[model samples]
Target: MLNHSAGIRPQTRQRVLDAITELGYRPNQAARALVTSRSQVIGVLVATRAAAYGVQKMVYEIEDAAGDAGYRVAIATCLSDDVSVRDAVDRLVAQAVEALVVVGPQAGVFNRLTAHPLAIPFVMVASDRHDDLSVSFDQVEGARIATRHLIELGHTRILHLAGPVGWVEADARMRGYLAELADHGLAPRPVIRCEWTADSGYRAACEVLGTTDVTAVFCSNDQTALGLLHALHESGRRVPQDVSVIGFDDVPDSAHYRPPLTTIRQDFAVAGQRAVGMLLAQLRAAPPPPADPVRPRLVVRDSTAPPG
Candidate 1:
Protein backbone atom coordinates (compact mmCIF):
# COMPACT_ATOMS: atom_id res chain seq x y z
CA MET A 1 0.00 0.00 0.00
CA LEU A 2 2.93 2.37 0.77
CA ASN A 3 4.61 1.59 -2.58
CA HIS A 4 1.21 2.05 -4.35
CA SER A 5 1.26 5.74 -3.33
CA ALA A 6 3.47 6.54 -6.38
CA GLY A 7 0.94 4.88 -8.75
CA ILE A 8 -2.29 6.42 -10.09
CA ARG A 9 -5.64 5.07 -8.88
CA PRO A 10 -7.17 2.46 -11.12
CA GLN A 11 -9.38 4.16 -13.81
CA THR A 12 -12.75 2.41 -13.58
CA ARG A 13 -14.91 4.31 -16.11
CA GLN A 14 -12.29 3.97 -18.84
CA ARG A 15 -12.13 0.21 -18.22
CA VAL A 16 -15.90 0.02 -18.49
CA LEU A 17 -15.81 2.12 -21.67
CA ASP A 18 -13.12 -0.10 -23.12
CA ALA A 19 -15.16 -3.22 -22.39
CA ILE A 20 -18.20 -1.62 -24.01
CA THR A 21 -16.21 -0.57 -27.04
CA GLU A 22 -14.74 -4.07 -27.45
CA LEU A 23 -18.23 -5.54 -27.12
CA GLY A 24 -19.56 -2.96 -29.65
CA TYR A 25 -21.99 -1.77 -26.97
CA ARG A 26 -23.38 1.79 -26.88
CA PRO A 27 -24.11 1.78 -23.14
CA ASN A 28 -23.98 5.48 -22.18
CA GLN A 29 -25.55 6.82 -25.36
CA ALA A 30 -28.33 4.24 -25.59
CA ALA A 31 -29.40 4.21 -21.93
CA ARG A 32 -29.21 7.95 -21.16
CA ALA A 33 -30.76 9.22 -24.41
CA LEU A 34 -33.33 6.50 -25.03
CA VAL A 35 -35.21 7.29 -21.82
CA THR A 36 -34.95 11.10 -21.84
CA SER A 37 -35.89 12.02 -25.43
CA ARG A 38 -33.94 15.20 -24.85
CA SER A 39 -30.48 16.50 -25.56
CA GLN A 40 -30.67 18.81 -22.48
CA VAL A 41 -29.38 21.75 -24.48
CA ILE A 42 -31.08 24.97 -25.62
CA GLY A 43 -29.81 27.49 -28.17
CA VAL A 44 -30.05 31.27 -27.79
CA LEU A 45 -29.49 33.86 -30.52
CA VAL A 46 -28.96 37.44 -29.38
CA ALA A 47 -29.70 39.72 -32.37
CA THR A 48 -28.27 43.02 -31.16
CA ARG A 49 -25.02 44.65 -30.21
CA ALA A 50 -23.45 43.45 -26.94
CA ALA A 51 -23.87 46.94 -25.42
CA ALA A 52 -27.66 47.08 -25.12
CA TYR A 53 -28.59 46.73 -21.41
CA GLY A 54 -32.17 45.68 -22.12
CA VAL A 55 -30.97 42.77 -24.22
CA GLN A 56 -28.48 41.80 -21.52
CA LYS A 57 -31.23 41.60 -18.89
CA MET A 58 -33.32 39.36 -21.13
CA VAL A 59 -30.36 37.00 -21.59
CA TYR A 60 -29.91 36.74 -17.82
CA GLU A 61 -33.54 35.84 -17.26
CA ILE A 62 -33.44 33.21 -20.00
CA GLU A 63 -30.26 31.75 -18.52
CA ASP A 64 -31.88 31.47 -15.11
CA ALA A 65 -34.89 29.71 -16.56
CA ALA A 66 -32.79 27.27 -18.57
CA GLY A 67 -30.70 26.37 -15.51
CA ASP A 68 -33.76 25.67 -13.40
CA ALA A 69 -35.13 23.37 -16.12
CA GLY A 70 -31.92 21.28 -16.21
CA TYR A 71 -30.97 22.61 -19.64
CA ARG A 72 -27.61 23.83 -20.84
CA VAL A 73 -27.55 27.06 -22.88
CA ALA A 74 -25.64 27.57 -26.13
CA ILE A 75 -25.47 31.23 -27.18
CA ALA A 76 -24.81 32.67 -30.67
CA THR A 77 -24.52 36.20 -31.98
CA CYS A 78 -26.56 37.46 -34.95
CA LEU A 79 -25.41 41.11 -34.65
CA SER A 80 -28.38 42.39 -36.73
CA ASP A 81 -28.69 40.88 -40.17
CA ASP A 82 -31.17 38.56 -41.85
CA VAL A 83 -28.39 36.48 -43.35
CA SER A 84 -26.47 36.35 -40.09
CA VAL A 85 -29.60 35.39 -38.16
CA ARG A 86 -30.25 32.49 -40.52
CA ASP A 87 -26.60 31.51 -40.34
CA ALA A 88 -26.66 31.57 -36.56
CA VAL A 89 -29.65 29.28 -36.65
CA ASP A 90 -27.71 26.85 -38.80
CA ARG A 91 -24.78 26.89 -36.39
CA LEU A 92 -26.96 26.18 -33.38
CA VAL A 93 -28.74 23.38 -35.18
CA ALA A 94 -25.38 21.72 -35.84
CA GLN A 95 -24.76 21.66 -32.07
CA ALA A 96 -27.78 19.40 -31.52
CA VAL A 97 -29.64 22.12 -29.62
CA GLU A 98 -33.30 21.21 -29.10
CA ALA A 99 -34.74 24.75 -29.11
CA LEU A 100 -33.83 28.44 -29.65
CA VAL A 101 -34.63 31.78 -28.00
CA VAL A 102 -33.86 34.60 -30.46
CA VAL A 103 -33.42 38.00 -28.82
CA GLY A 104 -33.63 41.58 -30.21
CA PRO A 105 -35.08 40.58 -33.57
CA GLN A 106 -36.13 43.53 -35.69
CA ALA A 107 -39.81 43.81 -36.63
CA GLY A 108 -39.01 42.67 -40.15
CA VAL A 109 -37.80 39.26 -38.97
CA PHE A 110 -41.27 37.80 -38.97
CA ASN A 111 -41.65 38.62 -42.67
CA ARG A 112 -38.24 37.16 -43.47
CA LEU A 113 -38.78 34.08 -41.33
CA THR A 114 -42.03 33.24 -43.08
CA ALA A 115 -40.04 32.37 -46.16
CA HIS A 116 -38.12 29.56 -44.45
CA PRO A 117 -39.26 26.63 -42.39
CA LEU A 118 -37.53 26.44 -38.99
CA ALA A 119 -35.89 23.15 -38.08
CA ILE A 120 -35.91 23.79 -34.31
CA PRO A 121 -38.44 25.50 -32.10
CA PHE A 122 -37.87 29.30 -31.84
CA VAL A 123 -39.00 32.00 -29.43
CA MET A 124 -38.48 35.66 -30.34
CA VAL A 125 -37.68 38.27 -27.65
CA ALA A 126 -38.64 41.99 -27.77
CA SER A 127 -40.55 41.74 -31.02
CA ASP A 128 -42.70 44.86 -31.42
CA ARG A 129 -45.15 43.00 -33.62
CA HIS A 130 -47.52 40.52 -32.02
CA ASP A 131 -46.85 36.82 -32.45
CA ASP A 132 -48.58 33.75 -31.03
CA LEU A 133 -45.47 32.90 -28.94
CA SER A 134 -44.21 36.35 -27.96
CA VAL A 135 -44.16 38.77 -25.03
CA SER A 136 -43.77 42.55 -25.53
CA PHE A 137 -43.83 45.65 -23.39
CA ASP A 138 -46.59 48.25 -23.86
CA GLN A 139 -44.78 50.88 -25.90
CA VAL A 140 -47.94 52.77 -26.78
CA GLU A 141 -49.19 53.14 -23.20
CA GLY A 142 -45.78 54.20 -21.94
CA ALA A 143 -45.43 56.93 -24.55
CA ARG A 144 -48.93 58.15 -23.80
CA ILE A 145 -47.98 58.44 -20.14
CA ALA A 146 -44.84 60.40 -20.98
CA THR A 147 -46.82 62.86 -23.11
CA ARG A 148 -49.66 63.26 -20.60
CA HIS A 149 -47.22 64.13 -17.83
CA LEU A 150 -45.94 67.06 -19.88
CA ILE A 151 -49.45 68.18 -20.89
CA GLU A 152 -50.59 68.20 -17.27
CA LEU A 153 -47.61 70.43 -16.46
CA GLY A 154 -49.08 73.12 -18.81
CA HIS A 155 -46.89 72.28 -21.77
CA THR A 156 -49.09 73.08 -24.78
CA ARG A 157 -46.31 73.65 -27.34
CA ILE A 158 -44.79 70.18 -26.97
CA LEU A 159 -42.82 68.37 -29.68
CA HIS A 160 -42.25 64.66 -30.37
CA LEU A 161 -38.88 63.11 -31.24
CA ALA A 162 -39.53 59.82 -32.99
CA GLY A 163 -37.20 56.91 -33.73
CA PRO A 164 -36.72 55.43 -37.22
CA VAL A 165 -40.03 55.62 -39.05
CA GLY A 166 -40.07 52.01 -40.24
CA TRP A 167 -39.52 50.29 -36.89
CA VAL A 168 -42.70 49.12 -35.17
CA GLU A 169 -41.66 50.16 -31.64
CA ALA A 170 -40.92 53.73 -32.69
CA ASP A 171 -44.21 54.04 -34.54
CA ALA A 172 -46.11 52.71 -31.52
CA ARG A 173 -44.65 55.38 -29.24
CA MET A 174 -45.40 58.07 -31.80
CA ARG A 175 -49.03 56.97 -31.90
CA GLY A 176 -49.30 57.37 -28.14
CA TYR A 177 -47.81 60.86 -28.23
CA LEU A 178 -50.20 61.88 -31.01
CA ALA A 179 -53.24 60.47 -29.23
CA GLU A 180 -52.34 62.19 -25.97
CA LEU A 181 -52.10 65.55 -27.69
CA ALA A 182 -55.15 65.09 -29.91
CA ASP A 183 -57.38 64.37 -26.89
CA HIS A 184 -56.91 67.98 -25.73
CA GLY A 185 -57.55 69.49 -29.21
CA LEU A 186 -53.91 70.63 -29.24
CA ALA A 187 -52.56 71.37 -32.71
CA PRO A 188 -49.87 68.97 -33.88
CA ARG A 189 -46.39 70.20 -32.98
CA PRO A 190 -43.50 69.47 -35.34
CA VAL A 191 -42.01 65.96 -34.92
CA ILE A 192 -38.26 65.28 -35.31
CA ARG A 193 -37.05 61.97 -36.69
CA CYS A 194 -33.73 60.52 -35.53
CA GLU A 195 -31.81 57.36 -34.79
CA TRP A 196 -31.68 56.02 -31.22
CA THR A 197 -28.58 57.92 -30.14
CA ALA A 198 -27.63 60.84 -27.93
CA ASP A 199 -25.95 62.65 -30.81
CA SER A 200 -29.05 62.32 -32.97
CA GLY A 201 -31.12 63.74 -30.11
CA TYR A 202 -28.76 66.69 -29.93
CA ARG A 203 -29.22 67.39 -33.62
CA ALA A 204 -33.00 67.13 -33.31
CA ALA A 205 -32.94 69.39 -30.25
CA CYS A 206 -31.09 72.05 -32.20
CA GLU A 207 -33.81 71.92 -34.85
CA VAL A 208 -36.42 72.40 -32.12
CA LEU A 209 -34.49 75.46 -30.83
CA GLY A 210 -34.73 77.25 -34.21
CA THR A 211 -38.54 77.31 -33.90
CA THR A 212 -40.04 79.59 -31.25
CA ASP A 213 -43.01 78.83 -28.93
CA VAL A 214 -41.80 75.29 -28.13
CA THR A 215 -42.39 74.53 -24.43
CA ALA A 216 -41.51 70.84 -24.13
CA VAL A 217 -40.20 67.79 -25.98
CA PHE A 218 -41.02 64.08 -25.62
CA CYS A 219 -38.00 62.09 -26.78
CA SER A 220 -38.48 58.57 -28.11
CA ASN A 221 -35.68 57.11 -25.97
CA ASP A 222 -33.35 57.81 -23.05
CA GLN A 223 -30.20 58.22 -25.13
CA THR A 224 -31.86 60.83 -27.34
CA ALA A 225 -33.10 62.63 -24.23
CA LEU A 226 -29.57 62.74 -22.86
CA GLY A 227 -28.38 64.44 -26.04
CA LEU A 228 -31.28 66.88 -25.87
CA LEU A 229 -30.21 67.74 -22.31
CA HIS A 230 -26.73 68.67 -23.53
CA ALA A 231 -28.09 70.73 -26.43
CA LEU A 232 -30.49 72.68 -24.16
CA HIS A 233 -27.70 73.51 -21.74
CA GLU A 234 -25.38 74.75 -24.49
CA SER A 235 -28.16 76.93 -25.92
CA GLY A 236 -28.96 78.60 -22.54
CA ARG A 237 -32.38 76.86 -22.20
CA ARG A 238 -33.22 75.53 -18.75
CA VAL A 239 -35.07 72.19 -18.48
CA PRO A 240 -38.52 72.19 -16.78
CA GLN A 241 -38.24 75.92 -16.09
CA ASP A 242 -38.06 76.82 -19.80
CA VAL A 243 -38.68 73.62 -21.78
CA SER A 244 -39.58 70.38 -20.02
CA VAL A 245 -38.18 67.13 -21.39
CA ILE A 246 -39.69 63.67 -21.09
CA GLY A 247 -38.12 60.47 -22.37
CA PHE A 248 -39.00 56.81 -22.88
CA ASP A 249 -37.14 53.79 -21.45
CA ASP A 250 -36.19 54.51 -17.81
CA VAL A 251 -32.66 53.19 -18.14
CA PRO A 252 -30.34 53.14 -15.13
CA ASP A 253 -28.60 56.50 -14.36
CA SER A 254 -31.53 58.54 -15.70
CA ALA A 255 -32.27 59.48 -12.08
CA HIS A 256 -28.75 60.87 -11.55
CA TYR A 257 -28.89 63.47 -14.33
CA ARG A 258 -28.61 67.17 -13.40
CA PRO A 259 -32.38 67.38 -13.62
CA PRO A 260 -33.45 63.79 -13.11
CA LEU A 261 -35.14 62.29 -16.21
CA THR A 262 -38.80 61.25 -16.22
CA THR A 263 -39.42 58.29 -18.53
CA ILE A 264 -41.32 55.06 -19.14
CA ARG A 265 -40.04 51.72 -17.90
CA GLN A 266 -40.23 48.32 -19.61
CA ASP A 267 -39.77 45.08 -17.68
CA PHE A 268 -37.50 43.31 -20.14
CA ALA A 269 -36.71 40.40 -17.83
CA VAL A 270 -40.38 39.56 -17.36
CA ALA A 271 -40.92 39.74 -21.12
CA GLY A 272 -38.05 37.34 -21.70
CA GLN A 273 -39.41 34.80 -19.21
CA ARG A 274 -42.89 35.03 -20.65
CA ALA A 275 -41.65 34.62 -24.23
CA VAL A 276 -39.75 31.47 -23.34
CA GLY A 277 -42.74 30.03 -21.50
CA MET A 278 -44.95 30.57 -24.52
CA LEU A 279 -42.37 29.06 -26.84
CA LEU A 280 -41.99 25.97 -24.65
CA ALA A 281 -45.75 25.41 -24.56
CA GLN A 282 -45.83 25.61 -28.34
CA LEU A 283 -42.86 23.28 -28.73
CA ARG A 284 -44.52 20.60 -26.60
CA ALA A 285 -47.80 21.04 -28.49
CA ALA A 286 -49.65 21.69 -25.27
CA PRO A 287 -53.43 21.31 -25.67
CA PRO A 288 -55.84 24.16 -25.12
CA PRO A 289 -52.92 26.51 -24.35
CA PRO A 290 -53.50 30.03 -23.17
CA ALA A 291 -51.04 32.90 -23.77
CA ASP A 292 -52.17 36.29 -22.61
CA PRO A 293 -50.60 39.29 -24.38
CA VAL A 294 -48.11 41.18 -22.26
CA ARG A 295 -48.72 44.89 -21.83
CA PRO A 296 -46.35 47.88 -21.23
CA ARG A 297 -46.85 50.54 -18.58
CA LEU A 298 -45.09 53.80 -17.57
CA VAL A 299 -43.02 55.32 -14.76
CA VAL A 300 -42.91 59.03 -13.89
CA ARG A 301 -40.15 61.01 -12.20
CA ASP A 302 -39.02 64.69 -11.79
CA SER A 303 -38.39 65.76 -15.39
CA THR A 304 -41.51 67.89 -16.01
CA ALA A 305 -43.07 70.85 -14.20
CA PRO A 306 -45.64 73.64 -14.83
CA PRO A 307 -44.51 75.94 -17.63
CA GLY A 308 -44.16 79.67 -17.00
Candidate 2:
Protein backbone atom coordinates (compact mmCIF):
# COMPACT_ATOMS: atom_id res chain seq x y z
CA MET A 1 0.00 0.00 0.00
CA LEU A 2 2.87 2.41 0.73
CA ASN A 3 4.32 1.63 -2.68
CA HIS A 4 0.93 2.10 -4.39
CA SER A 5 0.85 5.92 -4.29
CA ALA A 6 -1.62 6.58 -7.15
CA GLY A 7 -5.40 7.43 -6.71
CA ILE A 8 -4.47 9.31 -3.52
CA ARG A 9 -3.29 6.02 -2.01
CA PRO A 10 -6.30 5.25 0.27
CA GLN A 11 -4.65 1.99 1.27
CA THR A 12 -1.51 3.90 2.20
CA ARG A 13 -3.53 6.13 4.52
CA GLN A 14 -5.02 3.03 6.20
CA ARG A 15 -1.53 1.54 6.55
CA VAL A 16 -0.29 4.73 8.20
CA LEU A 17 -3.21 4.69 10.66
CA ASP A 18 -2.62 1.02 11.41
CA ALA A 19 1.06 1.71 11.99
CA ILE A 20 0.19 4.50 14.42
CA THR A 21 -2.11 2.12 16.32
CA GLU A 22 0.49 -0.63 16.41
CA LEU A 23 3.15 1.73 17.71
CA GLY A 24 0.77 2.79 20.52
CA TYR A 25 1.69 6.35 19.62
CA ARG A 26 -0.96 9.00 20.19
CA PRO A 27 -1.42 12.76 20.14
CA ASN A 28 -0.64 14.33 23.50
CA GLN A 29 -3.54 16.16 25.17
CA ALA A 30 -0.98 17.75 27.48
CA ALA A 31 0.68 19.54 24.58
CA ARG A 32 -2.65 21.04 23.54
CA ALA A 33 -3.44 21.84 27.18
CA LEU A 34 -0.16 23.65 27.65
CA VAL A 35 -0.65 25.65 24.48
CA THR A 36 -4.26 26.63 25.18
CA SER A 37 -4.23 26.31 29.00
CA ARG A 38 -7.37 24.18 28.77
CA SER A 39 -6.53 20.86 30.41
CA GLN A 40 -9.55 19.07 28.87
CA VAL A 41 -10.24 17.46 32.20
CA ILE A 42 -13.36 17.99 34.27
CA GLY A 43 -12.84 17.75 38.03
CA VAL A 44 -15.63 16.21 40.12
CA LEU A 45 -15.61 16.77 43.87
CA VAL A 46 -18.24 14.67 45.63
CA ALA A 47 -19.32 13.62 49.07
CA THR A 48 -19.09 10.01 50.17
CA ARG A 49 -21.64 7.62 48.67
CA ALA A 50 -23.59 7.41 51.94
CA ALA A 51 -24.05 11.15 52.19
CA ALA A 52 -25.35 12.04 48.73
CA TYR A 53 -27.24 9.88 46.20
CA GLY A 54 -27.58 12.42 43.42
CA VAL A 55 -23.92 13.29 43.51
CA GLN A 56 -22.79 9.69 43.37
CA LYS A 57 -24.88 9.11 40.27
CA MET A 58 -23.82 12.43 38.80
CA VAL A 59 -20.11 11.71 39.19
CA TYR A 60 -20.33 8.49 37.20
CA GLU A 61 -22.39 10.22 34.51
CA ILE A 62 -19.96 13.12 34.32
CA GLU A 63 -17.16 10.65 33.73
CA ASP A 64 -19.16 9.11 30.88
CA ALA A 65 -19.90 12.53 29.35
CA ALA A 66 -16.30 13.59 29.70
CA GLY A 67 -15.19 10.47 27.95
CA ASP A 68 -17.62 11.12 25.10
CA ALA A 69 -16.49 14.73 24.96
CA GLY A 70 -12.86 13.64 24.72
CA TYR A 71 -12.01 14.75 28.24
CA ARG A 72 -11.16 12.99 31.48
CA VAL A 73 -12.85 13.07 34.85
CA ALA A 74 -10.70 13.76 37.89
CA ILE A 75 -12.62 12.96 41.06
CA ALA A 76 -12.25 13.30 44.85
CA THR A 77 -14.69 12.05 47.46
CA CYS A 78 -15.17 12.22 51.23
CA LEU A 79 -14.69 15.93 50.94
CA SER A 80 -17.21 16.08 53.76
CA ASP A 81 -17.52 19.83 53.76
CA ASP A 82 -16.28 23.11 52.30
CA VAL A 83 -12.77 23.12 53.79
CA SER A 84 -12.18 19.65 52.42
CA VAL A 85 -13.71 20.67 49.10
CA ARG A 86 -11.27 23.57 48.79
CA ASP A 87 -8.42 21.24 49.53
CA ALA A 88 -9.67 18.75 47.00
CA VAL A 89 -9.99 21.48 44.39
CA ASP A 90 -6.35 22.37 45.02
CA ARG A 91 -5.44 18.75 44.40
CA LEU A 92 -7.37 18.64 41.10
CA VAL A 93 -5.71 21.89 40.11
CA ALA A 94 -2.40 20.10 40.49
CA GLN A 95 -3.68 17.55 38.02
CA ALA A 96 -4.43 20.39 35.59
CA VAL A 97 -8.22 19.96 35.50
CA GLU A 98 -9.52 22.88 33.48
CA ALA A 99 -12.89 23.02 35.27
CA LEU A 100 -14.61 21.89 38.47
CA VAL A 101 -17.93 20.30 39.51
CA VAL A 102 -18.77 19.91 43.20
CA VAL A 103 -21.51 17.92 44.89
CA GLY A 104 -22.94 18.19 48.42
CA PRO A 105 -20.59 20.49 50.31
CA GLN A 106 -21.77 21.66 53.72
CA ALA A 107 -23.14 25.12 54.47
CA GLY A 108 -20.90 28.05 53.53
CA VAL A 109 -19.32 25.97 50.79
CA PHE A 110 -21.20 27.90 48.11
CA ASN A 111 -20.88 31.11 50.09
CA ARG A 112 -17.14 30.67 50.36
CA LEU A 113 -16.93 29.96 46.65
CA THR A 114 -18.01 33.52 45.94
CA ALA A 115 -14.97 34.92 47.69
CA HIS A 116 -12.54 32.29 46.48
CA PRO A 117 -10.48 33.09 43.45
CA LEU A 118 -10.69 30.31 40.87
CA ALA A 119 -7.92 29.89 38.30
CA ILE A 120 -10.38 27.91 36.22
CA PRO A 121 -14.16 27.56 35.80
CA PHE A 122 -16.34 25.61 38.27
CA VAL A 123 -19.96 24.31 38.48
CA MET A 124 -21.81 23.26 41.62
CA VAL A 125 -24.05 20.25 41.14
CA ALA A 126 -26.45 21.00 44.04
CA SER A 127 -26.26 23.84 46.61
CA ASP A 128 -29.71 25.40 46.67
CA ARG A 129 -30.06 24.94 50.42
CA HIS A 130 -27.59 27.79 50.81
CA ASP A 131 -27.78 29.39 47.37
CA ASP A 132 -29.22 28.52 43.99
CA LEU A 133 -26.74 26.75 41.73
CA SER A 134 -25.51 27.80 38.34
CA VAL A 135 -27.97 24.90 37.40
CA SER A 136 -29.53 21.60 38.65
CA PHE A 137 -32.68 19.46 39.02
CA ASP A 138 -36.14 20.79 39.73
CA GLN A 139 -36.20 19.07 43.10
CA VAL A 140 -39.38 20.73 44.29
CA GLU A 141 -41.21 19.80 41.13
CA GLY A 142 -40.04 16.23 41.42
CA ALA A 143 -41.47 16.01 44.91
CA ARG A 144 -44.65 17.54 43.65
CA ILE A 145 -44.95 14.78 41.09
CA ALA A 146 -44.41 12.15 43.74
CA THR A 147 -47.05 13.68 45.97
CA ARG A 148 -49.51 14.18 43.15
CA HIS A 149 -49.14 10.59 42.10
CA LEU A 150 -50.14 9.42 45.55
CA ILE A 151 -53.06 11.79 45.70
CA GLU A 152 -54.26 10.74 42.27
CA LEU A 153 -54.32 7.20 43.56
CA GLY A 154 -56.67 8.38 46.36
CA HIS A 155 -54.04 8.20 49.05
CA THR A 156 -55.01 10.78 51.65
CA ARG A 157 -53.23 9.32 54.63
CA ILE A 158 -49.94 9.49 52.79
CA LEU A 159 -46.85 9.19 54.99
CA HIS A 160 -43.46 10.68 54.34
CA LEU A 161 -40.16 9.05 55.23
CA ALA A 162 -38.26 12.28 55.51
CA GLY A 163 -34.52 12.53 55.04
CA PRO A 164 -32.05 13.39 57.80
CA VAL A 165 -33.00 16.46 59.77
CA GLY A 166 -30.64 19.13 58.39
CA TRP A 167 -30.40 18.42 54.68
CA VAL A 168 -31.77 21.47 52.87
CA GLU A 169 -32.80 19.58 49.80
CA ALA A 170 -34.52 17.11 52.06
CA ASP A 171 -36.37 19.94 53.72
CA ALA A 172 -37.37 21.29 50.33
CA ARG A 173 -38.65 17.92 49.17
CA MET A 174 -40.53 17.39 52.41
CA ARG A 175 -42.07 20.79 52.04
CA GLY A 176 -43.18 19.98 48.53
CA TYR A 177 -44.66 16.76 49.79
CA LEU A 178 -46.51 18.57 52.53
CA ALA A 179 -47.61 21.38 50.29
CA GLU A 180 -48.95 18.96 47.76
CA LEU A 181 -50.91 17.19 50.49
CA ALA A 182 -52.30 20.40 51.88
CA ASP A 183 -53.26 21.51 48.40
CA HIS A 184 -55.41 18.39 48.19
CA GLY A 185 -57.16 19.47 51.41
CA LEU A 186 -55.67 16.63 53.37
CA ALA A 187 -53.93 16.93 56.71
CA PRO A 188 -50.21 16.18 56.68
CA ARG A 189 -49.87 12.64 57.96
CA PRO A 190 -47.07 11.24 60.07
CA VAL A 191 -43.50 11.82 58.92
CA ILE A 192 -40.78 9.46 60.06
CA ARG A 193 -37.31 10.92 60.03
CA CYS A 194 -34.64 8.55 58.89
CA GLU A 195 -31.00 8.61 57.91
CA TRP A 196 -30.28 7.79 54.27
CA THR A 197 -29.77 4.08 54.81
CA ALA A 198 -31.62 0.84 54.43
CA ASP A 199 -31.35 0.12 58.15
CA SER A 200 -32.72 3.50 59.01
CA GLY A 201 -35.64 2.84 56.71
CA TYR A 202 -36.23 -0.49 58.42
CA ARG A 203 -36.26 1.08 61.86
CA ALA A 204 -38.50 3.88 60.74
CA ALA A 205 -40.89 1.48 59.06
CA CYS A 206 -41.05 -0.62 62.21
CA GLU A 207 -41.99 2.49 64.12
CA VAL A 208 -44.68 3.41 61.60
CA LEU A 209 -45.97 -0.16 61.41
CA GLY A 210 -46.45 -0.27 65.15
CA THR A 211 -49.20 2.35 65.19
CA THR A 212 -50.36 4.24 62.11
CA ASP A 213 -52.24 2.45 59.33
CA VAL A 214 -50.59 4.47 56.61
CA THR A 215 -52.14 3.44 53.30
CA ALA A 216 -49.09 4.70 51.47
CA VAL A 217 -45.47 5.57 52.31
CA PHE A 218 -43.14 7.83 50.37
CA CYS A 219 -39.59 6.90 51.20
CA SER A 220 -37.00 9.64 50.94
CA ASN A 221 -34.68 7.44 48.95
CA ASP A 222 -34.53 3.95 47.46
CA GLN A 223 -32.51 2.40 50.27
CA THR A 224 -35.16 3.33 52.81
CA ALA A 225 -37.84 1.86 50.60
CA LEU A 226 -35.91 -1.40 50.55
CA GLY A 227 -35.86 -1.46 54.32
CA LEU A 228 -39.50 -0.49 54.58
CA LEU A 229 -40.54 -3.27 52.24
CA HIS A 230 -38.99 -5.83 54.57
CA ALA A 231 -40.62 -4.36 57.69
CA LEU A 232 -44.02 -4.23 56.00
CA HIS A 233 -43.80 -7.82 54.82
CA GLU A 234 -42.79 -9.04 58.27
CA SER A 235 -45.78 -7.24 59.80
CA GLY A 236 -48.10 -9.36 57.59
CA ARG A 237 -48.75 -6.52 55.17
CA ARG A 238 -48.68 -7.32 51.47
CA VAL A 239 -47.32 -4.60 49.16
CA PRO A 240 -49.88 -2.95 46.87
CA GLN A 241 -52.39 -5.37 48.31
CA ASP A 242 -52.08 -3.91 51.82
CA VAL A 243 -50.00 -0.74 51.54
CA SER A 244 -48.49 0.95 48.49
CA VAL A 245 -44.88 2.17 48.62
CA ILE A 246 -42.85 4.62 46.60
CA GLY A 247 -39.29 5.94 46.73
CA PHE A 248 -36.96 8.47 45.19
CA ASP A 249 -33.60 8.19 43.32
CA ASP A 250 -34.60 5.12 41.28
CA VAL A 251 -31.15 3.68 41.91
CA PRO A 252 -29.94 0.92 39.61
CA ASP A 253 -31.19 -1.80 41.91
CA SER A 254 -34.64 -0.32 42.36
CA ALA A 255 -36.05 -2.06 39.30
CA HIS A 256 -34.54 -5.33 40.42
CA TYR A 257 -35.83 -5.20 44.00
CA ARG A 258 -38.29 -7.78 45.29
CA PRO A 259 -41.63 -6.85 43.73
CA PRO A 260 -39.67 -4.33 41.66
CA LEU A 261 -39.82 -0.99 43.47
CA THR A 262 -41.49 2.07 42.03
CA THR A 263 -39.30 5.17 42.22
CA ILE A 264 -38.68 8.66 40.92
CA ARG A 265 -36.10 8.46 38.16
CA GLN A 266 -33.69 11.39 37.89
CA ASP A 267 -31.11 11.14 35.15
CA PHE A 268 -28.08 12.13 37.14
CA ALA A 269 -26.08 11.17 34.10
CA VAL A 270 -27.76 13.98 32.19
CA ALA A 271 -27.23 16.28 35.12
CA GLY A 272 -23.57 15.32 35.15
CA GLN A 273 -23.33 16.07 31.46
CA ARG A 274 -24.68 19.55 32.05
CA ALA A 275 -22.21 20.19 34.85
CA VAL A 276 -19.25 19.36 32.64
CA GLY A 277 -20.73 21.33 29.75
CA MET A 278 -20.99 24.37 31.96
CA LEU A 279 -17.47 23.93 33.21
CA LEU A 280 -16.15 23.60 29.67
CA ALA A 281 -17.92 26.78 28.65
CA GLN A 282 -16.29 28.55 31.57
CA LEU A 283 -12.88 27.12 30.76
CA ARG A 284 -13.17 28.37 27.20
CA ALA A 285 -14.03 31.86 28.44
CA ALA A 286 -17.39 31.43 26.76
CA PRO A 287 -20.81 32.25 28.18
CA PRO A 288 -22.54 29.31 29.81
CA PRO A 289 -26.28 29.80 29.92
CA PRO A 290 -28.01 28.30 32.91
CA ALA A 291 -28.52 24.57 32.52
CA ASP A 292 -32.18 23.65 32.33
CA PRO A 293 -33.28 21.87 35.47
CA VAL A 294 -33.62 18.11 35.00
CA ARG A 295 -37.14 16.75 35.27
CA PRO A 296 -37.91 13.69 37.38
CA ARG A 297 -40.14 10.94 36.00
CA LEU A 298 -41.96 8.44 38.16
CA VAL A 299 -41.14 4.88 37.18
CA VAL A 300 -44.11 2.83 38.31
CA ARG A 301 -43.61 -0.87 38.66
CA ASP A 302 -44.79 -3.55 41.11
CA SER A 303 -44.67 -1.37 44.22
CA THR A 304 -47.57 1.03 43.69
CA ALA A 305 -51.32 0.40 43.09
CA PRO A 306 -54.76 1.44 44.30
CA PRO A 307 -55.14 0.89 48.04
CA GLY A 308 -56.73 -2.54 48.47
Cα TM-score per model: 0.82, 0.84
| Colliding residue pairs in candidate 2 | none
Clash pairs for candidate 1:
138-296
Best by lDDT: 2
Q: Write the per-residue lDDT of candidate 1 for residues 1-308, one digit (tens) a residue.
A: 21235355468555755787798964353355457776767888877553456777888888887777766688888756679778887888877778888775356765555567787777776677566655666678888888888888788888888987666568888998999889988876767898888999999888768776888889998888899999999999898788888887778978877689988877877876776676567667864234444555556666678896
Q: Rate the local accuracy (lDDT) of all candidates.
A: 0.76, 0.78
- Alpha-carbon shift of residue 253 in model 2 (angstroms): 1.8
At residue 51, give the lDDT of candidate 2. Answer: 53
- Tens-digit lDDT track for model 2 on 123-202? 77765632223556676777888888888988888899988765655676798898898888998876789988899999
Deviation of model 1 at 94, angstroms: 1.9
Choose the strongest candidate by TM-score.
Answer: 2
Residue 190 deviation, candidate 2, in Å?
3.6
User: Where does candidate 1 stray beyond 4 Å?
Assistant: 1-37, 287-290
Name the lDDT of candidate 1. 0.76
